[model samples]
Target: MKAVGVIVEYNPFHNGHKYHLDETKRKTNPDCTIAVMSGNFLQRGEPALVSKWARTKMALEAGIDLVIELPYAFATQKAENFANGAISLLSALHCEEVCFGSENGTIDDFTSTVSFMKKNQQAYDHTTRQYLKEGYSYPKSASLAYSSLANHDTYVDLSKPNNILGYHYVKAIHDQKSSLKAETIMRTSAGYHDERFSHESIASATSIRKALFSAERDIKEIQNYLPQSTTKWLSAYFEEYKLFHRWEEYFTLLKYKLLTSSPSELANIYEAEEGIENRLLAFISESTSFQDFMEKIKTKRYTWTRLQRLCVHILTNTTKDQLKKINENPVATYIRLLGMSQKGQRFLNHVKKDVEIPILSKATGFSDDLFTLDQKAAQTYLAIFPEPLRTQLLRQEYAKPPIRFNEEQQIYL
Candidate 1:
C-alpha cells in the first residue's frame, strides 16, 4: 500500500488544517494517509487546547486514515529535531511521500535552500554565531544568516514560521538521506501566528485560540473555522475540563518547579542555557502570571517561543542528561497508534509484516525511556485537572487502545 505522511499538531483542527490535509491528499493521492501528531504538549511548548485523543478523533474523521503520536522526545523539540523525528518515523514506516504546508509552497525552493546551506555551511554557521553573539534571537539570527548567504536572492524566506519549519522538513529528508519524496502546498488564507481572525472561514489556530480564550469567550466565533468533529470534541473537552489547556493553568505548578529548584539544578534542565537559570530565579518571584513572568524574563537572546519550550522542559522535569541519552538514537523507537479508521487498519495489517519498527496499539509494557517520557507527558498534562477527571484521563494512558473508527458502522468501536 502506498502511504503518504503528514507531520501535524492539530491543536484543535481548524479549517486551515483541513485545507492543508485536503490539498496534501489531492497532491499525493496515496492509498493510505498517515499523520504523526504531537501529543498532549506541542512544538511551541504550549499544551494542546484538548487532549491527544480528542485531536486524533478530529484527524481520523477529517480524512487521515491513520493517526500516530509523535513521541514527546520529538514533539517538544526545536524545528530541526522535530522534523528529524517526524521525517524519520515516516521513513521508518516506509512512507512513499511526506507533505507539509508552507508559506513558500514550492518544493524546489526548499530543496534549493538545503543545498545552498550545505554548500555555504561553514560561512552560514559563522554568520549565525556572529548574530547570536550580538544577541539576536535564534530565529532572527538564522534568517539574517540566510539572507547574508543569499546576498541578492533568498529563495525560501527562512523568516516566516511555516517556511522555517518547511525548510527543516526538507533538510531532514535530505540529511537522513531517506527515500520518501517531499512536497509542499502554499498556505491559503491565514498566517501561522495571526492573533485575530481576518478571514471568514479560515483563521490561524492562534487566532481561533485567542477567540476561545478571549474576555468575550465566544466559542461560536471560531466554530466556522473548525470541522464538526473538532468543534464537538473541543467543546466536550472544555465542558468537562472547565478550562482549556494554557500556560497560565499550569503557572502555579511551574512556579513551584521554578522556585524549589536551585540555580545549579536549573542549569541541568534542557534549554536552560547561558545563566538563564539565575535570570529565572531573579524574576520568577516578582511575576504575577505566566505572561508577566515571561515578559520579565524575556531577552534579545531568548524568544518567547524558545522560553516557553524551556518551560515545558522544566515543567516535565526533563533534564539535559536524560534527553541526551534518548536522542542518542535520534529517531523514535516505535510507532504508537493513537487512532485508526477501517482503511488505516487494513493498511497497517498489509504493511505490518514488513515494517521495520514495532507498532504499538496499547501503551502498557513499553519500558523504553522514549515511551516512558511519552506517558509522563500525558500524565503531566492531566495534572492540570482536578482529581476524578484527572485520574479518569490518566488511566487511558495505560489501558486505552488505539481508537477505532468504523466507517461502515459510522461510529468509533
Candidate 2:
C-alpha cells in the first residue's frame, strides 16, 4: 500500500491541521497516512498543552492512519535536528511522499533554494561567519548570508517559524538524497506566532491552544473545528489534568543536574560547544526562573529558542554523543504507536511484515534505546504539572481510550 508521511506536533488538532491532512490526501491519495509526531514536549521547548497520547488520538480521528512518536531528544530540538529526525522517520517508514504546509507553497522555490545552498557552500559559509561576527544570531546570520548569495530576500524571512521549518525540511530531503517526493500546501489565515484567532476556516495551533486554555472559549466552541474523537479525548483528559503553567517546577531538577554534572559531562550534552558548559554553569548559579536563565546565557551567536532546547537536552540527558550517533544513523528504527483506527490497524497489518522498524503498540518496560529515553522523559515531564495532573499522566496509558474512525467517514479527497 502506498503511504504518505507527515511530521507534526499536532499540539492540539485544529482546522489548519485538518486542512493539511486533506490536502496531502488530495495530492498524493496514499492508501495510508502516517504521522511522526512529537511526544510530550514540542520543538519550541515547551511542554505540550496535552499529552502525546491525546494528541495522537486526535490525529487518528482527524484523518491520520498511524502515529509514531518523535523521540523527546529530537522533539525539543532546533529546526535542523527536528527536520532531520522527522525526515529520517518518514524515510524509515518507507513513505513515498511528504506533504507540509508552507508560506511559499511551491516546491520548485524550496528546491531552488536548496540547490543554491548546496552549490555555493563556500560563499554561504563566509557570509554566515561574517554576519555572526557582526553580532547576528546564527539563524539570522544564515538567513542574511543565503539572501545575499541568492539575491533573493525570501531566505531572509527564515526568521518566520513555518518558513524556517520548511527550509530545513527541504534541506534535509536534499541532504539525504531520498526517493521520497516533497510537496507543500499553502498556509492560510493565522500565522505561526500570531497570538490571536482568525475567522477563516484555517486556525493556527497557537490560537487553538490559547482558546482551549482560556475561559473566554468553551469546550463546545472549540469542538467545532476539531474532530469528534479529539473533542472526546480532550474533554476527558482536561477534566483530570491542568495544562502546564510555570517552567520553574523543572528548574530545580535542571539546576541540580547542571550543578552536579561535571563540566566535562555537560560538554557531552547536545549543542554544548566551545565552553558553553561554563556559561551554563554561570547561568545556573545566578538565574532563577527558566526565562531568566535563558536570557542570562543567550548570546548573539545563539538564539533564545536554541538555548532553551539545549537546556531541555541537558535536562533530558540527551548527550552530544547520542546526537552525533543518531545523526549518523538517522533512520527511525522503531514506531511507538500512539493511537490508530481500524483501517489504520489493517494498514499496520499490511506493512508489518515489510517494515524496517519495530512497531510498538504497548509501552512495555523493556526497551533501552530512544524509546526508553522517551518513556523516561514523559514520566519526568509530568512531575512539572500539578498534583492529580501528575498522577493522571502517570496512569493515563492504562485507561486512555484509543481513537476509532467511523467506516462511513470520507477517506478520499
Candidate 3:
C-alpha cells in the first residue's frame, strides 16, 4: 500500500494541523498516512503543552494512520538535524511522499535554494563567516550570505523561522537522495509567530497555545477548530498534569556540567565551537532564566534560538560527537509506537517482517541499540512529570490501549 509521511509537533493539535492532514491525503491519496512526531519536548527547546500519548491520540483521531515517536535527541535540535531525523524515520517506514506547509508553496524555489547551497558550499561558507564577523546572528549571517549569492533580498526573508525550517526539509530529502517526493501547501492567513487567533481557518499554533492558556479562552471559542477527541484528551491531560512553567529548575545542574567539563568534553556537544565553553560558563554564573542566559551568550555569529538549543543539548548530555555519528549513520532502526488505530495494527502486521527497523509497542526495557544518551534523555524527559503521572509513564506499557481510527475519524469542519 502507498503511504505518505509527515513530520510534526502537534503540541496541541488544532484546526491548522487538521487542514494540513486533509490536504496531504487529498493530494497524495496514499493508502495510509504516518506521522513521525516530537515527544515530550519540541524543537523550540520547550516542553510540549500536552503529553506525547495525548498528542498521538489526537493525530489518530484526526485521521493519521500511525503515530511514532521522534527521539528526544533528534526532536530538540536545529533545522537540518531535525529534518534529517524526521526524514530518515519516514524513509525507513517506506513512505513514497512527504507533504508539508510552506509560505512560498513553490517546490521549485525550495529545490533551487538547496541546489545553490550545495554547489556553492565554499563561497557560501566564507560569506557566512564574513557576515558573522559583521555582528549578525547566525540566522542573520546565513540569510545575508544567501541573499548576497541570490542577488535578492528574498533569501534574507526566507530565514524567518518557518521558511528556514522548510528549506532544511527540502535539503535533507535531496541530500539523502531518497525516493520520497516532496510537496508543499501554502500556509494561509496566519504566520508562525502571530499572536492573535483572528483567522477562522488558519490560526497559527502559537495563537492556539496562547488561547489554550488564556483565562478568557472558552470551550466555545476553541470548539470550532479542535476535534472533539483532541478537546477530550486535553481536558483529561490538563486536569491530571501541570505543564512546565519554568526552565530554571535545571539551571544548577547545567552549570555544574559546564564548569566541570573540559573544553575537550564540551567540544563533543553539538554546535560547540571555538571558545564557546568559556562563554557558556561565564554566562551561567550571572544569567538567570533560560531566555536571559541565551541573551547573555548571544553573539552576532549565533542566534538566541541556536544558543538555546545548544544549552538544552548540554543539559541533556547530547555531545557533538554523538550528533555527528548519528547524522553520518542516519537511520530509524526502531519505531516506538506512541498510539495507533486498529487499521494501523493491521498495517503494522503487514509490514512487520519486511521493515528494516524493529517496531516496539511496549517500553518495558531498553535494547542494546539504545544508546546511553537515549536512556539519559528518557530519564531527564520524564523528570518533569508530577507524581502518579510520573509513575504512570513508567508502567504505561502494561496498558497499551490502541486508538481505533475507523470509528473515531472526523472530517474537517
Candidate 4:
C-alpha cells in the first residue's frame, strides 16, 4: 500500500490540523496516511496538554490510519534533531512521501534553499558559529547567516517559524539520503506562536492552548476551532485527570531541581551549559512562576524555547553524556506504535516484515535505553498529578497495548 507521513504534535487536534491532513490526503492520495507524533513532551520544551494516547485517539478519529511515537530523544530536541527523528520514522515505515505544513508551501523553494546551503556549507557554518560567539540566539544566527549567503537571491525565508522548520525537514531528507518525496501545505490563518485566536474556525494549537489555560476562557469557547474528536478527547481528559498540563505546574519541581543540584551537576544536564546553572540558581528563590523564571532567565542569547528544553532535561534528569551518545549515532532503533485505525493495522501487518526497523507495539517486555528515556518522560509528565490517578495512569501506559480504532464499529478498542 502507498503511504504518506506527517510529523505532528496534535497537542490537541484542531481545525487547522484537520485542514492540513485533508490537504495532505488530497495531494498525496496514499492508501494509508501516518502521523509520527511527539509523545508526552513536545519539541517546544513543554508537556503536551494531554497524553500521547489521547492525541493518538484524536489522530485516528480524524482519519489518520497510523500513529507512531517520535522517540523522546528526538521529539524534545531542537529543529535539526527533531526533523531527523520524524523523517527517520517515516522512512522506517516505508512511506513514499512526507508532507508538512509550512509558511512556504512551495516545495521547490525548500529544495532550492537546501541545495544552496549544501553548496556553501563551509561558509554557512563559519558565519553561524561567529554569530553564536557574538551572542546571537541559534535561530537568529541561522537567519542572519542565510541572509549573508543568499544576499541577492530569492529563497525560502528562514525567519518565519514554519518556514524554518520546513527547511530543516527538507535538509533532513537530503542528509539522511532518503527517497521520500517532500511536500508542504501553506499554513493558513493563525500563526505558530499566536497566543490568541485569529479566525472563527481555525486557530493555532498555541492559541487554543492559551484559551484552555486562561482564567476567563474555557474549552467551550474554543470548541468551534477543533474537530468533534478533539473536543471529545479533551473533555474526556479533563473529566478523568481533572487538569490540563502547563509549564506552571512543573515550576516548583524545576525550582527544587535547580536549587538542590550543584552547579557542576547542573552542567551535566543537556542544554544546561555556559553558566546557565548559576543564573537558574540565582533566580530560583525570587521567581514566582515558570513564566517569571523564564522572563528572568531569557536573554537575547537564550531563546524561551531553548530554556524550556533545558528545563525538560532537568525534569527528566537526561544528561549531556546520554544525549551525546545518541546524537553521535542517531538512528531510530525502533518505532513505537501508539495507536492505529483498522487500515493502519492492515498496513502495518503488510509492511512489518519488509520494514528495516523494529515496530514496537508494546513496551512491557522491552528494555532499550531510548525507550526507557521515553518511559521516564511519560512518568515525569504524570508526576505532577496526585496519588492514585498518577499511579493508575503510569501502570496503564506500560500494561496497555497500542490502541486500535475500529472504523466499522466507530469506537476505540
Error of 3 at 26 (Å): 1.2
- Backbone clash pairs for candidate 4 read none
TM per prediction = 0.97, 0.85, 0.86, 0.98
For candidate 4, lDDT tens digit of each residue in 1-413? 99999999999899999999999999999989999999989999999999998899899999899999999999999888988888988998889999999987899999999999889999999999999999999889988998888842468988888888889889988989999999999999999999887689999999899889988977788899999989999999999878899899898888887888999999999998789889988888999999999999899999999999999999999999989988886668898898999899999988999888777777788778688799899899999988987899899888878999997787977
Q: Rank the candidates by TM-score, best first.
A: 4, 1, 3, 2
- The predicted structure with the larger lDDT, 2 or 3, is 2
Native-vs-model 2 lDDT?
0.76
Please identify model 4 stretches exceeding 4 Å from their true place: 151-153
Clashing pairs in 1: none
Candidate number with greatest lDDT: 4
Task: For each of the candidates, give the backbone clash count.
Answer: 0, 1, 3, 0
Tell me the tens digit of each residue's lDDT in model 2 across 122-222.
98899999998898887899888877777554432454677678878888887787778888888777787767756645667777777876778867887
Per-residue error at 139 for model 2, in Å?
1.0
Worst 10 residues of 4 by lDDT: 150-159
Which should have the higher TM-score, number 2 or number 4? 4
For residues 1-413, write the lDDT of model 1, one tens digit per residue: 89999999998898998999999999989898999999988999999888888899999889888999899999998898899899988988888999999988889888888888889999999999999999999888988998887843547888888888898988988878899999999998889999977888999989888888888866766788988888888888878778889999999999999989999999999989899999999999899999999999998889998899999989888889888987776787899999999999989998888889888998778778788888778888989878887898888877899999986666998
lDDT for model 4:
0.90
Question: Which consecutive 10 residues in model 3 have the weakest lDDT in total?
Answer: 404-413
Better of 1 and 4 by lDDT: 4
